[model samples]
Target: MIGLAPIFSYDDQLKRFLLEDVGSGDVTTRSVFSYEARHRKASAKIIAESDGVFCGGPFGSRILSYSDPMAKFEAIPDGQPYAKGECLVAMEGALESLLLCERVILNLLKHLSGISSLTASYVEMVRLLRKSSRSLRITGTRKT
Candidate 1:
């Protein structure tokens, strides 16, 4: 099984992305949430709007951890199949922290999941077609 080790290997890249998205600080979250409110506990979940092969669960957990070390993040394993309306990730943390990382997390999840889902569909097609040709195979390239 693919584990968190592979996800941790991308820490540097993920940090760069978080830094780019959260340059200086999150002005909106800071302004909208008073000091007390910022620390108020909140819980949220990312629900799938469509069926797809879920990806980035570990990365999502890592992103949330960066925002608030005490935050709790739980998600289905990456590469798991999900259905529309299913919860992909569930997290609880300070309101400010959650809001700060929400966009970055959502964007990553959507982008990665889309690619995984599409690739799964292509592989399924190949599997169906391969019955007629024993030598046929489907492989991925690093070009993307």
Candidate 2:
């Protein structure tokens, strides 16, 4: 079977890679923009493109919080059903902070959500198959 790319030597390295990708600072966002004078909340809507058992809602929420401590996070609990185009989580926060954190948030969402989707697909396929009958019954009848 084909293997996933960049197979880490250590299991914990995946989170390190993600943090490294984000870097110590987002230089562009920091240099180019100024914080707005008045406080305002920004809502980030996480919409699922396809049906999947939603598995990473909390991680996605934590991504936002990690990006900006002041962010207000609300998410449908993890391991719940999420239909296509449904909102999984929402964050209300400062516009500049939200923009700075959007990519990281999406990355987490994409990765864990994909895992959930693939697992669900495998489960559904197994559920539809007559595995015991196909293997055991076929073997017994053939022997007779």
Candidate 3:
């Protein structure tokens, strides 16, 4: 299987997304639990919603693991094609831990999957246009 190397970056896209979603801050998580809160281990499964060439499973797992070290993930091999509604990866860890990492993991997956679907759509459109063009031809007509 082709291994599309994962990109581990600390950049603005993610930081901004977190800032927007977290709002003033994650007051809920912080208020309910201490700054160093810990919780029971839990599991989460990431699944694809549509059919397309699968990518970024490893990237996603890495992002999740980085967000929460205690979180463990098992993802299908990189560049492994998967079908619609396929389980891309399984995450196991503390509820708090998983929650903390959820957005980053999803962001990575979303970016990769969105690009895959868009490329597929563009390819299909090109194929259809090619077929249509092949059906037409220029013909010579006698001048009256």
Against the true structure, whose lDDT is highest? 1
Across 1-144, the per-residue lDDT of candidate 1 in tens digits comes to 465455445888777788999987789888888999999999999999999999998898898899899999999988899999999999999998898888889999999999999999988888888888856677767897
**Could you give me the TM-score of model 2 versus the true structure?**
0.68
Worst 10 residues of 1 by lDDT: 1-10
By the TM-score metric, which is better: model 1 or model 2? 1
Whole-model lDDT per candidate: 0.90, 0.67, 0.69
lDDT of 1 at 137: 72
Q: Which number leads on TM-score?
A: 1
Model 3 worst lDDT window (10 residues): 8-17
Q: Sort every candidate by lDDT, greatest first.
A: 1, 3, 2
lDDT of 2 at 4: 69
Instruction: Give Cα distance to truth, residue 81, candidate 2, Å.
Output: 2.7
TM-score against truth, every candidate: 0.88, 0.68, 0.60
- lDDT score at residue 89, model 3, on the 0-100 scale: 81
Cα lDDT tens digits, model 3, 39-101, are 767799888777766567766665555456767888877655677788988999877667776
